[model samples]
Target: MDISKYNFYVGTSRGTLLFNSDKPNNIQSAKSEEISEVTSLNFGRNENELLIGYDNGCVNIFDIIERKYIKTPELQGEGRVVGIGYVNKSIVIGKHDGIINVWNGKRNNYFDTHLDEKGTLDTLVCNENRHGVIGTGGEFNDLKLWDIETQQCIFKAKSLGHDMLNLPIPTSVRGITFFPEDNYLSVCATKEGHVLLYDDRAQRRPVVKFLEKKASYTTIACAYRERQCLAGTTRGYMQVMDMKAGKCLRTFTNFTGSITSIVCDPLEPYVITTCLDRHLRIHNLETKELLHKVYMKQNLTKVLVKSIVKDEPVEDTSEKEKVDEEYEEIFENMETVVSSKKLKKQKRHDEDVTDKPRRKKKKKLKQAEG
Candidate 1:
């Protein structure tokens, strides 16, 4: 809530967890009683208020300062909510059914729009340079731009023409972000592990593409540098690249699974990432060094970090060392735990195969031949 302090909120399977960001690494977590997982998280028009979307089709607003939920607004449709963004005092809900609901307030004032009807919505971004302009991307669909006030689709990217060797380009978008300096310029990550920059005003095709064989980017952050940005990939790595030069500057990896979401601390040179390995990591953007890491009980999907460097150091060094030792044990078990999850999934698949009926063999004909 307080922008001056170092803090953050993490969205997980059970609910949201608030990290105190203290030197000793204290955590305060809140679980939703009726929800199985938190689908989306956004800061409202007021920075102190947080809007949370649940898998059970409920939207709740919370005050970050008081660490308390304010209200639960009624939603029109019920489905798995994927992405949420706050713009112009309204909350935009991106659902798994491809429905984008724009709710103004708690009085049931909302409007609906469709994204990718066949697939789940993957990312939603509000333009910092352009008012009323928003972007949405899905699993198999291309990126789309819309004006929420007018409730109309303004732009849709076309599949790129050809590759260097005359091969067709892939258009499935994985993550998207608008350039803060220019409203017409936007960047997106494709399923092919490529980062493409699109100029909405100039042409439908991308202006530049980078990281052809690096990693499958799942999420991106835009505030790390002036002409460069950071992107989190499906292979549990993060890369910083120069958009104009189409070059990768650095890469960071601290998790064993996919990086789901990333946020850059505006006040410090830090980047926070949430991963499917049930870890939240803080790293230096320039040095690519791990500053601090926390292993939550649930897999974190999204993270909102405020600050990384505290103004004053804690007096007790033993307390900090004790917490770090505990986290080290937790971090050491992350890989084993994640592997167990994969084993469980494989076991379920094996059970499904064993559930099928097998054909019986004939006996009399074989005996006569013998």
Candidate 2:
């Protein structure tokens, strides 16, 4: 696997882990700033900066190159920072107690929207195309989208009213994501193994629903292909669901434990996931193959990836290698021909090859005696 093109940072159970794909073994832990468990994290305004959200309700920025904290921003909320997303020039923070705060690193507070303190806000994500748009969801609460600039709820999911037994279906949303291609299209995964896709421009309810029976999907992300999504379950498996066909396409297995977060490359065909099993792994979405993995001491909660998109075409040498290998078998059993071409040229001077030099010496001696 060519891991040189990717760059990312992992937020562990204790602190942040500075990771490099080029040298996966050369890892550095950031234990400064007196911060506790890094609950959530995302990239700041640029690739050189990273935004960190701690369990103690503290938010700070760190320089990736300097390997130090730039500044810490005091939060007005009072809960574990469960989720974070950077949009526009500010960051949208979601606390465990269901408080959504948008801060621009200034003194004044932008807006503090409440999302049902009864349930824990487990997931939050921002759209890649829109700056002000962000999505949030949690236990017992359906998904909702907010516009930070306007400070209004632009969209709220309609609950799946009741089950066959007449009990209200629980909406324990564990993961949420926005599509990179179409910002209006979004998806979320729930504890009940239900993955729902919502098109805000179409309706308030889920336009499509996929069920991964008997598995608790912990995190969700966009897949390698369009009209498809990837999700990680508590059963130690990652599912690739075709949102367009409404069925699971493939299941990636071999995870040690429940996955904490899943990140898919937008421009590449690779996916990375953080697991409670204390390992960071990258997988190929097309082949469902494990490309690379690195072990860490703590459970990984979040990962911020840096993708370098290129326009050049990649050459495939698989067919060429196969052909060369087939031709090699013909010569492997053959005898060693040491002088195939070199001895053929010597055949032309066979008669006078060595005697011509002796004959010239004899003529010189005769001329000197005469």
Candidate 2's C-alpha lDDT?
0.81
Which runs of model 2 end up more than 4 angstroms from their true locations? 110-112, 308-370
lDDT of 2 by residue, 133-229 (tens): 8888888778988887787889999998888999988879988887777879989999998999999989987999887769898888887688788
Residue 290 in candidate 2 has what lDDT? 89
For all predicted structures, in order, the TM-scores are 0.75, 0.80
Evaluate all candidate structures by whole-model CA lDDT and list the values in order: 0.75, 0.81
Error of 1 at 290 (Å): 1.4
List the pairs of residues colliding in candidate 1: none
Tens digits of per-residue lDDT for model 1, 1-370: 2333567788887766555545435677875554557777877877788878778777778777777776566666658776778877778877666677787775444445554456556667788689888887776567788898887889888877778999866666777887777788889987778788889888887788786575777888786567677888888888888998988887786679999888886646778788999887878887777877877778888787654454685579898899999999999888654588898999999887776433222455566788
Cα distance off (Å), candidate 1, residue 7: 0.7
